[model samples]
Target: MDFEKIQNEIGGFSRYQVVVITTVAWLAFSAGFGTQSAVFISAIPKYRCAVPPIDDPDVYPSLGESDIKNYTIPYDTATAEYDSCNRYDYNLSSCQGDGDLSCVTFDEDPGTIPCDQGYHYDQTYYKETTRTQWDLVCER
Candidate 1:
Protein backbone atom coordinates (compact mmCIF):
# COMPACT_ATOMS: atom_id res chain seq x y z
CA MET A 1 0.00 0.00 0.00
CA ASP A 2 2.87 2.41 0.87
CA PHE A 3 5.02 2.33 -2.34
CA GLU A 4 7.35 5.14 -1.25
CA LYS A 5 7.88 3.54 2.16
CA ILE A 6 8.68 0.14 0.61
CA GLN A 7 11.06 1.72 -1.90
CA ASN A 8 12.96 3.52 0.90
CA GLU A 9 13.02 0.32 3.03
CA ILE A 10 14.42 -1.74 0.14
CA GLY A 11 16.96 0.96 -0.68
CA GLY A 12 16.88 1.81 -4.41
CA PHE A 13 19.93 0.48 -6.35
CA SER A 14 22.03 -0.17 -3.24
CA ARG A 15 25.26 -2.22 -3.00
CA TYR A 16 23.15 -5.24 -1.96
CA GLN A 17 21.11 -4.89 -5.13
CA VAL A 18 24.30 -4.67 -7.22
CA VAL A 19 25.67 -7.83 -5.57
CA VAL A 20 22.43 -9.74 -6.14
CA ILE A 21 22.18 -8.61 -9.77
CA THR A 22 25.83 -9.45 -10.40
CA THR A 23 25.46 -12.90 -8.85
CA VAL A 24 22.36 -13.67 -10.91
CA ALA A 25 24.00 -12.35 -14.08
CA TRP A 26 27.10 -14.46 -13.49
CA LEU A 27 25.00 -17.54 -12.83
CA ALA A 28 22.95 -16.91 -15.97
CA PHE A 29 26.14 -16.56 -18.01
CA SER A 30 27.55 -19.78 -16.62
CA ALA A 31 24.27 -21.60 -17.24
CA GLY A 32 24.21 -20.34 -20.82
CA PHE A 33 27.68 -21.78 -21.44
CA GLY A 34 26.73 -25.05 -19.80
CA THR A 35 23.69 -25.48 -22.03
CA GLN A 36 25.68 -24.68 -25.17
CA SER A 37 28.66 -26.89 -24.28
CA ALA A 38 27.18 -29.79 -26.22
CA VAL A 39 28.18 -28.13 -29.49
CA PHE A 40 31.82 -28.78 -28.66
CA ILE A 41 31.32 -32.29 -27.31
CA SER A 42 28.89 -33.42 -30.02
CA ALA A 43 30.86 -31.92 -32.89
CA ILE A 44 31.07 -33.78 -36.19
CA PRO A 45 34.58 -34.78 -37.13
CA LYS A 46 36.10 -35.41 -40.53
CA TYR A 47 34.89 -38.78 -41.75
CA ARG A 48 34.60 -41.02 -44.76
CA CYS A 49 33.16 -44.30 -45.90
CA ALA A 50 34.70 -47.22 -44.05
CA VAL A 51 36.15 -49.46 -46.71
CA PRO A 52 36.45 -52.89 -45.22
CA PRO A 53 39.76 -54.69 -45.47
CA ILE A 54 40.09 -57.28 -48.15
CA ASP A 55 39.69 -60.61 -46.37
CA ASP A 56 40.95 -62.71 -49.28
CA PRO A 57 44.44 -61.62 -50.29
CA ASP A 58 44.06 -63.54 -53.53
CA VAL A 59 41.01 -61.54 -54.52
CA TYR A 60 42.25 -58.06 -53.58
CA PRO A 61 45.41 -57.21 -51.74
CA SER A 62 45.10 -55.41 -48.45
CA LEU A 63 45.48 -51.72 -49.28
CA GLY A 64 46.69 -48.90 -47.08
CA GLU A 65 44.42 -46.06 -45.97
CA SER A 66 45.43 -43.80 -48.80
CA ASP A 67 45.31 -46.64 -51.28
CA ILE A 68 41.82 -47.54 -50.13
CA LYS A 69 40.69 -43.96 -50.55
CA ASN A 70 42.26 -43.73 -53.98
CA TYR A 71 40.81 -47.00 -55.19
CA THR A 72 37.40 -47.02 -53.60
CA ILE A 73 36.45 -43.45 -52.65
CA PRO A 74 35.35 -41.00 -55.29
CA TYR A 75 36.88 -37.52 -55.43
CA ASP A 76 34.19 -34.88 -55.65
CA THR A 77 35.38 -32.16 -58.04
CA ALA A 78 32.73 -29.71 -56.93
CA THR A 79 33.73 -29.91 -53.30
CA ALA A 80 37.36 -30.70 -54.16
CA GLU A 81 37.24 -33.29 -51.42
CA TYR A 82 36.73 -37.03 -51.10
CA ASP A 83 33.09 -38.04 -50.92
CA SER A 84 32.25 -39.13 -47.40
CA CYS A 85 28.93 -40.91 -47.90
CA ASN A 86 29.49 -42.82 -51.13
CA ARG A 87 32.21 -44.89 -52.77
CA TYR A 88 32.79 -46.08 -56.30
CA ASP A 89 31.12 -49.40 -56.99
CA TYR A 90 33.89 -51.47 -58.52
CA ASN A 91 34.57 -55.09 -59.41
CA LEU A 92 36.78 -56.87 -56.93
CA SER A 93 37.88 -59.41 -59.54
CA SER A 94 39.16 -56.66 -61.82
CA CYS A 95 41.36 -55.29 -59.06
CA GLN A 96 42.98 -58.64 -58.37
CA GLY A 97 46.75 -58.85 -58.94
CA ASP A 98 46.69 -55.22 -60.06
CA GLY A 99 49.41 -53.51 -58.08
CA ASP A 100 48.48 -50.34 -59.88
CA LEU A 101 45.13 -49.37 -58.44
CA SER A 102 44.87 -46.52 -60.91
CA CYS A 103 45.02 -48.98 -63.78
CA VAL A 104 42.18 -51.02 -62.31
CA THR A 105 39.07 -50.73 -64.43
CA PHE A 106 35.59 -50.06 -63.15
CA ASP A 107 32.06 -50.55 -64.46
CA GLU A 108 31.37 -48.58 -67.64
CA ASP A 109 30.12 -45.83 -65.36
CA PRO A 110 31.04 -46.94 -61.87
CA GLY A 111 28.67 -44.54 -60.18
CA THR A 112 28.95 -43.73 -56.53
CA ILE A 113 26.89 -45.73 -54.07
CA PRO A 114 26.07 -45.30 -50.38
CA CYS A 115 28.49 -46.90 -47.99
CA ASP A 116 27.39 -50.42 -47.18
CA GLN A 117 29.94 -51.18 -44.49
CA GLY A 118 29.94 -48.09 -42.27
CA TYR A 119 31.78 -44.81 -41.73
CA HIS A 120 35.34 -43.98 -40.70
CA TYR A 121 35.81 -40.94 -38.46
CA ASP A 122 39.01 -38.97 -38.24
CA GLN A 123 39.80 -39.00 -34.54
CA THR A 124 42.67 -36.56 -34.75
CA TYR A 125 40.56 -33.64 -33.57
CA TYR A 126 37.83 -35.37 -31.61
CA LYS A 127 38.54 -38.81 -30.28
CA GLU A 128 34.83 -39.60 -30.05
CA THR A 129 31.74 -37.57 -30.89
CA THR A 130 28.03 -38.07 -31.33
CA ARG A 131 28.35 -38.03 -35.10
CA THR A 132 30.99 -40.75 -34.99
CA GLN A 133 29.48 -42.83 -32.21
CA TRP A 134 25.96 -42.80 -33.66
CA ASP A 135 27.08 -42.73 -37.32
CA LEU A 136 24.98 -39.59 -37.91
CA VAL A 137 26.93 -38.18 -40.82
CA CYS A 138 24.83 -39.58 -43.65
CA GLU A 139 21.28 -40.75 -44.31
CA ARG A 140 20.23 -44.22 -43.18
Candidate 2:
Protein backbone atom coordinates (compact mmCIF):
# COMPACT_ATOMS: atom_id res chain seq x y z
CA MET A 1 0.00 0.00 0.00
CA ASP A 2 0.98 3.67 -0.56
CA PHE A 3 1.63 5.42 2.81
CA GLU A 4 1.74 8.91 1.24
CA LYS A 5 -1.56 8.34 -0.60
CA ILE A 6 -3.30 7.02 2.57
CA GLN A 7 -1.97 9.97 4.63
CA ASN A 8 -3.28 12.50 2.06
CA GLU A 9 -6.69 10.74 1.96
CA ILE A 10 -6.99 10.64 5.77
CA GLY A 11 -5.85 14.27 6.14
CA GLY A 12 -6.36 15.73 9.64
CA PHE A 13 -9.26 15.41 12.08
CA SER A 14 -12.68 15.62 10.39
CA ARG A 15 -15.35 18.29 11.04
CA TYR A 16 -17.78 15.59 12.25
CA GLN A 17 -15.19 14.32 14.76
CA VAL A 18 -14.59 17.83 16.06
CA VAL A 19 -18.32 18.43 16.54
CA VAL A 20 -18.84 15.11 18.29
CA ILE A 21 -15.85 15.65 20.57
CA THR A 22 -17.01 19.16 21.39
CA THR A 23 -20.53 17.98 22.14
CA VAL A 24 -19.28 15.19 24.40
CA ALA A 25 -16.99 17.59 26.24
CA TRP A 26 -19.80 20.09 26.73
CA LEU A 27 -22.13 17.38 28.06
CA ALA A 28 -19.49 16.14 30.47
CA PHE A 29 -18.81 19.68 31.70
CA SER A 30 -22.51 20.36 32.12
CA ALA A 31 -23.05 17.16 34.10
CA GLY A 32 -20.13 17.96 36.37
CA PHE A 33 -21.35 21.51 36.88
CA GLY A 34 -24.83 20.32 37.79
CA THR A 35 -23.50 17.75 40.29
CA GLN A 36 -21.22 20.29 41.93
CA SER A 37 -23.98 22.88 42.14
CA ALA A 38 -26.25 20.42 43.91
CA VAL A 39 -23.48 19.56 46.36
CA PHE A 40 -22.71 23.22 47.07
CA ILE A 41 -26.36 24.09 47.50
CA SER A 42 -26.70 21.25 49.98
CA ALA A 43 -23.39 21.82 51.71
CA ILE A 44 -23.42 22.81 55.39
CA PRO A 45 -21.20 25.63 56.54
CA LYS A 46 -18.64 25.30 59.34
CA TYR A 47 -20.04 25.70 62.85
CA ARG A 48 -18.79 26.41 66.38
CA CYS A 49 -20.36 26.25 69.82
CA ALA A 50 -23.46 28.37 70.20
CA VAL A 51 -23.53 31.42 72.45
CA PRO A 52 -24.66 30.67 75.98
CA PRO A 53 -27.98 32.07 77.10
CA ILE A 54 -27.64 35.20 79.18
CA ASP A 55 -30.64 34.44 81.37
CA ASP A 56 -29.55 30.96 82.29
CA PRO A 57 -28.88 31.09 86.02
CA ASP A 58 -27.23 27.73 86.53
CA VAL A 59 -24.76 27.38 83.64
CA TYR A 60 -22.10 30.01 83.32
CA PRO A 61 -24.17 32.66 85.05
CA SER A 62 -23.68 36.20 83.69
CA LEU A 63 -21.61 34.74 80.83
CA GLY A 64 -21.63 36.64 77.53
CA GLU A 65 -20.76 35.82 73.95
CA SER A 66 -17.17 36.98 74.25
CA ASP A 67 -16.59 34.82 77.30
CA ILE A 68 -18.03 31.74 75.60
CA LYS A 69 -15.87 32.20 72.51
CA ASN A 70 -12.78 32.86 74.58
CA TYR A 71 -13.23 29.76 76.71
CA THR A 72 -15.33 26.97 75.21
CA ILE A 73 -14.10 26.55 71.66
CA PRO A 74 -10.88 24.59 71.04
CA TYR A 75 -8.08 26.40 69.21
CA ASP A 76 -5.84 25.07 66.45
CA THR A 77 -2.36 26.37 67.25
CA ALA A 78 -0.83 25.39 63.89
CA THR A 79 -3.55 27.08 61.81
CA ALA A 80 -4.29 29.81 64.35
CA GLU A 81 -7.98 28.94 63.98
CA TYR A 82 -10.55 27.33 66.25
CA ASP A 83 -11.64 23.74 65.75
CA SER A 84 -15.04 23.38 64.09
CA CYS A 85 -16.27 20.51 66.24
CA ASN A 86 -14.17 19.73 69.30
CA ARG A 87 -14.52 21.92 72.40
CA TYR A 88 -12.74 22.10 75.72
CA ASP A 89 -13.72 19.50 78.31
CA TYR A 90 -15.12 22.17 80.59
CA ASN A 91 -18.86 21.75 80.37
CA LEU A 92 -21.12 24.78 80.60
CA SER A 93 -22.50 23.50 83.89
CA SER A 94 -18.98 23.10 85.26
CA CYS A 95 -17.70 26.47 84.06
CA GLN A 96 -18.25 29.00 86.83
CA GLY A 97 -16.81 32.02 85.02
CA ASP A 98 -14.46 33.14 82.29
CA GLY A 99 -11.44 32.29 84.45
CA ASP A 100 -12.49 28.63 84.46
CA LEU A 101 -12.02 28.43 80.68
CA SER A 102 -9.42 26.08 79.27
CA CYS A 103 -8.29 27.77 76.08
CA VAL A 104 -4.54 27.16 76.16
CA THR A 105 -2.76 23.84 75.55
CA PHE A 106 -5.78 21.98 74.19
CA ASP A 107 -3.60 18.94 73.39
CA GLU A 108 -2.51 18.71 76.98
CA ASP A 109 -6.13 18.23 78.03
CA PRO A 110 -7.22 14.61 77.46
CA GLY A 111 -10.87 15.30 78.13
CA THR A 112 -11.44 17.28 74.93
CA ILE A 113 -14.60 16.09 73.20
CA PRO A 114 -17.28 17.10 70.67
CA CYS A 115 -19.43 20.16 71.28
CA ASP A 116 -22.39 19.29 73.42
CA GLN A 117 -24.41 22.44 72.86
CA GLY A 118 -25.89 23.64 69.58
CA TYR A 119 -23.66 24.81 66.75
CA HIS A 120 -23.19 28.34 65.43
CA TYR A 121 -22.81 28.53 61.68
CA ASP A 122 -20.21 30.81 60.10
CA GLN A 123 -22.36 32.85 57.74
CA THR A 124 -19.59 35.14 56.56
CA TYR A 125 -19.59 33.67 53.07
CA TYR A 126 -23.11 32.31 52.67
CA LYS A 127 -26.35 33.80 53.91
CA GLU A 128 -27.78 30.32 54.43
CA THR A 129 -26.73 26.76 53.73
CA THR A 130 -28.19 23.27 54.03
CA ARG A 131 -27.14 23.26 57.66
CA THR A 132 -30.25 25.34 58.38
CA GLN A 133 -32.56 22.60 57.15
CA TRP A 134 -30.54 19.51 58.14
CA ASP A 135 -28.63 19.13 61.40
CA LEU A 136 -25.53 17.51 59.85
CA VAL A 137 -22.75 19.50 61.47
CA CYS A 138 -21.43 17.36 64.31
CA GLU A 139 -19.72 13.94 64.46
CA ARG A 140 -18.87 11.62 61.58
Candidate 3:
Protein backbone atom coordinates (compact mmCIF):
# COMPACT_ATOMS: atom_id res chain seq x y z
CA MET A 1 0.00 0.00 0.00
CA ASP A 2 3.10 2.30 0.28
CA PHE A 3 3.45 4.38 -2.90
CA GLU A 4 7.12 5.33 -2.19
CA LYS A 5 8.14 1.64 -1.72
CA ILE A 6 6.36 0.67 -5.00
CA GLN A 7 8.06 3.56 -6.90
CA ASN A 8 11.53 2.56 -5.49
CA GLU A 9 11.00 -1.11 -6.51
CA ILE A 10 9.96 -0.06 -10.05
CA GLY A 11 13.32 1.77 -10.44
CA GLY A 12 13.96 4.59 -12.89
CA PHE A 13 14.50 4.45 -16.69
CA SER A 14 16.25 7.26 -18.66
CA ARG A 15 13.94 9.87 -20.26
CA TYR A 16 15.37 9.02 -23.71
CA GLN A 17 14.72 5.34 -23.17
CA VAL A 18 11.11 5.98 -22.06
CA VAL A 19 10.48 8.18 -25.11
CA VAL A 20 12.04 5.58 -27.49
CA ILE A 21 10.00 2.75 -25.95
CA THR A 22 6.74 4.69 -26.24
CA THR A 23 7.48 5.59 -29.87
CA VAL A 24 8.38 2.01 -30.74
CA ALA A 25 5.20 0.70 -29.10
CA TRP A 26 3.09 3.24 -31.02
CA LEU A 27 4.81 2.34 -34.32
CA ALA A 28 4.26 -1.37 -33.80
CA PHE A 29 0.57 -0.85 -32.96
CA SER A 30 0.07 1.39 -36.00
CA ALA A 31 1.84 -1.03 -38.32
CA GLY A 32 -0.41 -3.91 -37.26
CA PHE A 33 -3.72 -2.00 -37.33
CA GLY A 34 -2.83 0.08 -40.38
CA THR A 35 -2.20 -2.98 -42.50
CA GLN A 36 -5.47 -4.56 -41.39
CA SER A 37 -7.41 -1.37 -42.17
CA ALA A 38 -5.93 -1.13 -45.66
CA VAL A 39 -6.83 -4.75 -46.44
CA PHE A 40 -10.44 -4.34 -45.27
CA ILE A 41 -10.89 -1.15 -47.32
CA SER A 42 -9.59 -2.86 -50.46
CA ALA A 43 -11.75 -5.98 -49.94
CA ILE A 44 -14.98 -3.94 -49.52
CA PRO A 45 -14.97 -2.49 -53.06
CA LYS A 46 -13.94 -5.83 -54.62
CA TYR A 47 -17.11 -7.43 -53.23
CA ARG A 48 -19.48 -4.77 -54.65
CA CYS A 49 -20.08 -2.71 -57.79
CA ALA A 50 -19.37 0.66 -56.09
CA VAL A 51 -19.20 2.40 -59.47
CA PRO A 52 -16.74 5.30 -59.62
CA PRO A 53 -17.56 8.72 -61.00
CA ILE A 54 -17.09 9.15 -64.78
CA ASP A 55 -15.15 12.36 -65.28
CA ASP A 56 -12.72 11.71 -68.14
CA PRO A 57 -13.77 11.05 -71.76
CA ASP A 58 -10.93 8.53 -72.09
CA VAL A 59 -12.46 6.54 -69.24
CA TYR A 60 -15.30 5.36 -71.57
CA PRO A 61 -14.02 5.53 -75.17
CA SER A 62 -15.93 5.12 -78.51
CA LEU A 63 -16.92 2.22 -80.82
CA GLY A 64 -15.92 1.12 -84.37
CA GLU A 65 -16.47 3.12 -87.62
CA SER A 66 -18.15 0.54 -89.88
CA ASP A 67 -20.27 -0.70 -87.00
CA ILE A 68 -21.57 2.82 -86.27
CA LYS A 69 -22.47 3.74 -89.87
CA ASN A 70 -24.15 0.40 -90.53
CA TYR A 71 -26.06 0.35 -87.26
CA THR A 72 -27.04 4.02 -86.76
CA ILE A 73 -28.24 4.87 -90.35
CA PRO A 74 -31.90 4.93 -89.23
CA TYR A 75 -33.64 2.04 -90.97
CA ASP A 76 -37.00 0.46 -90.23
CA THR A 77 -35.73 -3.15 -90.13
CA ALA A 78 -32.19 -3.02 -88.80
CA THR A 79 -29.91 -6.04 -88.88
CA ALA A 80 -26.86 -6.54 -86.63
CA GLU A 81 -23.78 -7.50 -88.69
CA TYR A 82 -21.44 -8.26 -85.78
CA ASP A 83 -22.38 -11.05 -83.39
CA SER A 84 -21.90 -8.64 -80.51
CA CYS A 85 -24.01 -5.83 -82.12
CA ASN A 86 -27.41 -5.06 -80.63
CA ARG A 87 -30.08 -2.30 -80.72
CA TYR A 88 -28.72 -0.67 -77.58
CA ASP A 89 -25.09 -0.71 -78.78
CA TYR A 90 -23.34 2.67 -78.80
CA ASN A 91 -21.35 3.92 -81.79
CA LEU A 92 -17.92 4.65 -80.34
CA SER A 93 -16.26 5.72 -83.64
CA SER A 94 -18.16 8.98 -83.87
CA CYS A 95 -17.25 9.90 -80.32
CA GLN A 96 -13.54 9.38 -80.98
CA GLY A 97 -13.53 11.02 -84.43
CA ASP A 98 -15.35 14.27 -83.61
CA GLY A 99 -15.43 14.09 -79.78
CA ASP A 100 -19.01 15.39 -80.21
CA LEU A 101 -20.87 12.09 -80.47
CA SER A 102 -23.06 11.82 -77.37
CA CYS A 103 -25.24 8.86 -78.35
CA VAL A 104 -25.17 5.93 -75.91
CA THR A 105 -27.55 3.10 -75.06
CA PHE A 106 -27.93 2.23 -71.41
CA ASP A 107 -29.55 -1.19 -71.85
CA GLU A 108 -27.13 -2.77 -74.35
CA ASP A 109 -23.93 -4.49 -73.28
CA PRO A 110 -21.01 -2.44 -74.63
CA GLY A 111 -19.31 -3.94 -77.73
CA THR A 112 -15.83 -3.55 -79.24
CA ILE A 113 -14.95 -3.60 -82.97
CA PRO A 114 -11.42 -4.00 -84.34
CA CYS A 115 -10.34 -1.32 -86.89
CA ASP A 116 -7.55 1.18 -87.61
CA GLN A 117 -9.89 3.94 -86.45
CA GLY A 118 -10.28 4.66 -82.73
CA TYR A 119 -13.48 2.67 -82.14
CA HIS A 120 -13.83 0.51 -79.07
CA TYR A 121 -16.36 -0.21 -76.30
CA ASP A 122 -15.89 0.33 -72.59
CA GLN A 123 -17.42 -2.83 -71.20
CA THR A 124 -17.58 -3.68 -67.49
CA TYR A 125 -18.74 -7.18 -66.62
CA TYR A 126 -19.10 -7.89 -62.89
CA LYS A 127 -19.83 -11.39 -61.63
CA GLU A 128 -22.52 -11.70 -58.97
CA THR A 129 -21.11 -14.80 -57.25
CA THR A 130 -18.52 -12.80 -55.26
CA ARG A 131 -21.14 -10.25 -54.27
CA THR A 132 -23.42 -13.08 -53.11
CA GLN A 133 -20.67 -14.37 -50.84
CA TRP A 134 -20.18 -10.92 -49.31
CA ASP A 135 -23.92 -10.59 -48.83
CA LEU A 136 -23.96 -13.90 -46.91
CA VAL A 137 -21.14 -12.68 -44.66
CA CYS A 138 -22.96 -9.40 -44.01
CA GLU A 139 -26.12 -11.29 -43.05
CA ARG A 140 -24.23 -13.33 -40.50
lDDT by residue (6-94, candidate 2, tens digit) is 76688855797699999999999989988878754685766776634421436456565455555667678999878777776654554
The TM-score measured for candidate 1 stands at 0.56
- Candidate models: Cα lDDT each: 0.72, 0.63, 0.40
Cα deviation of 133 in candidate 1 (Å)? 0.5
lDDT of 1 by residue, 17-68 (tens): 7899999999999999989889656888887886544323453565656766
Model 1 clashing residue pairs (backbone) = none
Question: Compared with the true structure, what per-residue lDDT tens digits does model 3 show for residues 5-101?
Answer: 8766777556876899999999999899977774344332222111111112354345343444444322234563332222223454344333344
**Deviation (Å) of 9 in candidate 2:** 40
Judge candidate 1 against the unseen true structure and give its global Cα lDDT, from 0 to 1.
0.72
TM, every model:
0.56, 0.47, 0.25
Q: Count the backbone clashes (under 3 Å) in each candidate.
A: 0, 0, 4
TM-score of 2: 0.47
Candidate RMSDs in order:
7.7, 10.5, 14.2
Q: What is the lDDT of residue 137 in candidate 3?
A: 28
Better of 1 and 3 by TM-score: 1
Which 10-residue window in model 1 sums to the lowest lDDT?
A: 51-60
